[model samples]
Target: MTSALSLDGVFLVPPEHHVPDTDRAAATQLLGCDDRTLDTLVRRGLTVRDDRFDGRDLFNLALHSGTGRTVPEQAFAFSLRWMRGTAESLLAPRTLSFTLTAACRCADVVLALPRPDRYGGAVIPAPEADVVAGTTVSATIRTEGRAVPLRSPVLRGLVEEFAALGVRWVKLPDALREDESLVTTHRVATCESASRWLARRCREAGYAARTRIGWVVGMLDLVHAWVEVTDDDGETKVVDLIFAGFAAGVPGANPLLTDPAVALRTNRLVPTGFEVGARVARHDCDAPVTVRIKPVKE
Candidate 1:
């Protein structure tokens, strides 16, 4: 390529405009508002900018369309977090936050499940965790490894949380609930967006890869995304995790009971073994956006 200065005749360069030192321009500039996209949304009247999604184009979209500002509520908390100390010690002095989830049509019971635990399984489970409860929901539901109490406030809270999310769930004390009736359920999330993010991370890690687009479209088909780690000897270990879009359905379950899994998934979104394209969308954030996966080699 040759420079304009070297051209035989005077070459014309496209005119460039610089930002002015005006206060309005300075403030709006920080918002990254462009005259083209943002001006369009606000002109239409859709959404208002609150303290969410951070002054991004999505805000402008809502502003123009006159759309109601949608915010994610503090959904629910987990019961397991209450199991912090020994079961005997954990009985009293406990508080849970929640909204009623499901309506149990069969029985006259009103259930309130626990709030979802953000840090539950995402980070490493406590080192002393399984040493006490043997790493199962059934074990932790009991006090001192015995089901003598039959029921606790924890179980009651568990019942209520599920009622909030429109799921008919029951608080099954480990000792009282029927084992065969309570089948172990497996749930999965199909996060198309996260798949793209992971593909980017894989490329960043020096692996030439692209997301399996067909597989992502079949998130219902592909079912899950697992973390695969390899040691120096090249023996690979894969850990299954809770990511975005997980837990759509399961047997004999309600939303409140299920969302705790999502809470664990949410708290684990950052720094807990990650790559790019690691999230899937819960709601369509407008049309799907894709970045460069890998540059084409010549």
Candidate 2:
């Protein structure tokens, strides 16, 4: 049996670290605030004392339309940033500094489950949300490992093969907690499930890879995730395995951005990773707004 390769360094930033700069104008609209209120706040300024505008606020006020109560921090952070920019821009056009720090470090939960050969086996385990106390032996979740670099040739190859699966998404009820559950319970592939399956396939194939939990642009509520591969050419690229089949007409696009609207919106990519204490800086003073990832804190 091949030894299971651990995917280290593939850390995910905690939800608190995902504070996104938001559009103040759009956020006002989504929060159902009136124009006069926005004008008042802009003229007077965002009060630091108000709990609604506190630093810990992670609500995605830009979600002009969504059913959930807890908004994405990225949306809320971006909104606050926009407000600051607008207020300062009126006085003078100066470079604004934006910094993102992970709220708390995160430890990965690695699970060892029954590996199904390509022919037949459970691709992933069900009850992914269930917590095990002491007696559980079917699977083992480990928490220690280094982050895997996505620029390995082996990983790139896995991306190609997984995309070749040509898995079609099976739309299940929103009632389902995780899209990956669909794969274990129903054998269908959604963006979430497909990415999970791809990560698994990469592991089974003996390449170091891991799954990430985040969203594609413009579809934050739907909550999209994908795989990051280290290529032989020293490039780390995000592979949307399922979306590759759906959008690229094949699965090997360099960035593999899935949403058409987001693809049309920008030429720059928002920096992605799961590093705690890593800094995400957005430079909008230039021609195109670009995000830069800084070294993770020790």
Candidate 3:
């Protein structure tokens, strides 16, 4: 079933709309490096257009410049500032579209395609999926959507309430060490683990919450997991603990949980069923699947 929401009139800010910029002097100051070092970064592939440097380029250089060394706090702050700024810009109401395709060699296949839904101040209108079934199966799915400022009071209240749970965000390698049997069994959790934990907690609290597996679209799309919580009024909201923790630099702050201005820029959320791409099988026979995603020009 497709969602009833529509994104026809929303205005979306593309990634190019808010590329952070800085002069040479400001760039040096932000990186805490000398001109020569900055030049070295340029030689290493950092683009400097019209004497202005891109914040993302500078952040990457600073993050990986020194071998076996921790990134300086100043440089980290510079990255966070740019990230926050870009995220804020992406929160503006906007429309977007993408073409998604999946192919597999199998007699029977079920492709879990991108479905229309509302979250992060965005609404994805339902689109038709073209499916061809045979010895080889192929499906083409198109999605067009719009995002507006998230200002729901119930969502905001849920954010504040979840914050009271005090769950610490931990990335992998470290997160693997924590207990996953229960949310309270460990203080730190990764996105998937945390989402599952939060879903259970929300259900216990009399709220309808479910863990969702999908992709977080950005400069690079990555498999991600999050939660969807529905209020008594039947309104649903997204709860992404990992993104919230990273954006706010504090688990308690959780701006991504509700603050539209702090939304991820150059990045959007795409939820799917069970897994991304396609799942093809016939009488215990499984087929390998290939999936591709590209922006559709309107």
Candidate with maximal TM-score: 3
Instruction: Rank the models by TM-score, top first.
Output: 3, 2, 1
Taken over the whole model, the C-alpha lDDT of each candidate is: 0.25, 0.35, 0.47
Local accuracy of candidate 3 as per-residue lDDT tens digits, 104-171: 44445444455434243332434344233344322233322233343445444555555565554433
Cα RMSD (angstroms) for every candidate in the order listed: 23.7, 19.6, 14.8
Q: Write the per-residue lDDT of candidate 1 for residues 1-298, one digit (tens) a residue.
A: 1211111111111122111222323323433444453344334542233312223223222222221222100111121232223334322221221111222232322221111121222112222321121111111110111112212233223223333433212222223222222211211112332334333444455444333211111112222333333223333322222221123322223233233221121111111122333322212223332211111122
Q: How much is the lDDT of residue 23 in candidate 2?
A: 55
Best by lDDT: 3
Once all C-alphas are superposed, what RMSD does model 2 give against the true structure?
Answer: 19.6
Candidate 2 TM-score, C-alpha based: 0.32
TM-score of each: 0.18, 0.32, 0.46
Backbone clash numbers for all candidates listed: 50, 24, 4
Global CA lDDT of candidate 2, please? Answer: 0.35
